[model samples]
Target: MGKNRLQLENHLFILPDYLNHPFISGNKLRKLKYNVLEAKKQKKETLLTFGGAYSNHIAAVAYAGKEYGFKTVGVIRGEELADSISQNPTLTFAQNCGMEFKFVSREQYRNKNNPLFLNQLKEAFHNIYVLPEGGTNALAVKGCEEILEEADAKFDYICCPVGTGGTISGLINSSFKHQKIIGFPALKGDFLNKEITKFAAKTNWELNLDYHFGGYAKVTDALIAFINTFKLQYNIPLDPIYTGKMMFGICDMIQKGYFDENAKILAVHTGGLQGIAGMNTVLKQQNKPLIV
Candidate 1:
């Protein structure tokens, strides 16, 4: 996925997959590449997906649909956000890309995977290609498999932020048996273990649960400070939701002597920078420092 590696520290390198595309960046691009092709093969006219107000997946899917000549539909969670779309950067961007929105309640969104609910959506939108929330599916994993090049095998460990487990699963499948794949989950729970095993063909990966920092989208002042400091120091923008926490944990582990001496580490910078504006909005309402 990357050849221009940025050295963050001694034996630590970052694969800036974010530079792949302006809108559909990083893992979002990897996860959608094959799915978009599949949708075209199916002769679909509309691409439908689900996400929250500030979802990176929603923003990416909208832009992808616009770029690929398909109508985009976002089944957004939280109906209350419907009227406030203008205030949300991600949603606004998606809307500007010609994405139609169907704001559903949290309870209704929970039924997103149910057969009846899916059937209802299928009935409502003809010739629609449905992408699951977080965009994790078999095809997504296949696309993610291309993230790590043969040259990446030189590293002892590969690290990435885990959302729906698709990216790490692909890395697990493609990585050398001698290389360890470490996933820093953005969400809390042991549920991802089972979810990841569904698509991953190998057992070379493990999740680090300690870095989620109070769970998905929940961040402390320290995390905000770290993100700002990291960008200031390295000129790499990280979203508060995923990559920021992963980097925080990685730095903490390095300081704690978690890695073997002289071991090389490669971290995948899965982009979600689109969410920064929305997150900073929340931070401001709470009177907290922003991720500059």
Candidate 2:
């Protein structure tokens, strides 16, 4: 439960940051820490952010806003989700935290960053502090940079799951020159390289694109089995959306002899465990095995 690294096997370690908090743990905690501070510093009374129904960022922002005395609004992606909040654990938790919802169509949600679209949001929610989807702004990256400690310097490679590129960018900034930062992206795309370049100060990081299993939120039976087996073996739970895929890739790479002999690897466990219930719901509908 501490910040100590949990060694899974020889030379493979995990930073159990998911234990940082029961809710806003892992990279979500790191990503939100300074953003919340900046909102308070700006004297903002309301925090507005965007995310999918099962988004960890939305859940984190809602809890952080409640804990920090700010009203929260979540611009959820799927409009139909509004009526099904009771069925979705993540959205239900956010609502219980007093987070207001603004559900939009998938088409409209794509314009979430559009200037005119944002202006409409500004008009609707006055005096709001806006956080981007996945909460990967510069301030969030600043918070993520602190995830690595001096003790982590001994690691030859630092690894984490990449969402909107904030956490990995922070790792890239804080990593030693000799340490290679490896990212396993949860979403499929070649677009992340450019996104990471926007905030990362170093060129030491690289993304392993082979293990997404599919696009965002997509899962397969093999991934589910790996996640369940991994938890049974290591007693460490990894969320399907991000950490699970990243861990699967790292393990696959090790089996394929990707890492050099004696290479020290630190894999960061960025939490999204709250999404498990929702994911299990989807798996049940598909008659697939649950993550457990």
Highest-lDDT candidate = 1
Pairs in steric clash, model 1: none
Worst 10 residues of 1 by lDDT: 1-10
Against the hidden true structure, what lDDT does model 1 obtain? 0.94
What candidate 2 gets wrong by more than 4 Å, as runs, is 1-3
lDDT for each candidate structure: 0.94, 0.92
In candidate 2, list every pair of residues with a backbone clash.
Answer: none
TM-score of 2: 0.98
Tens digit per residue, CA lDDT, model 2, 100-162? 999999999999899999999889998899999999999999999998998888889999999
Where model 1 places Cα greater than 4 Å from the true spot, the runs are none
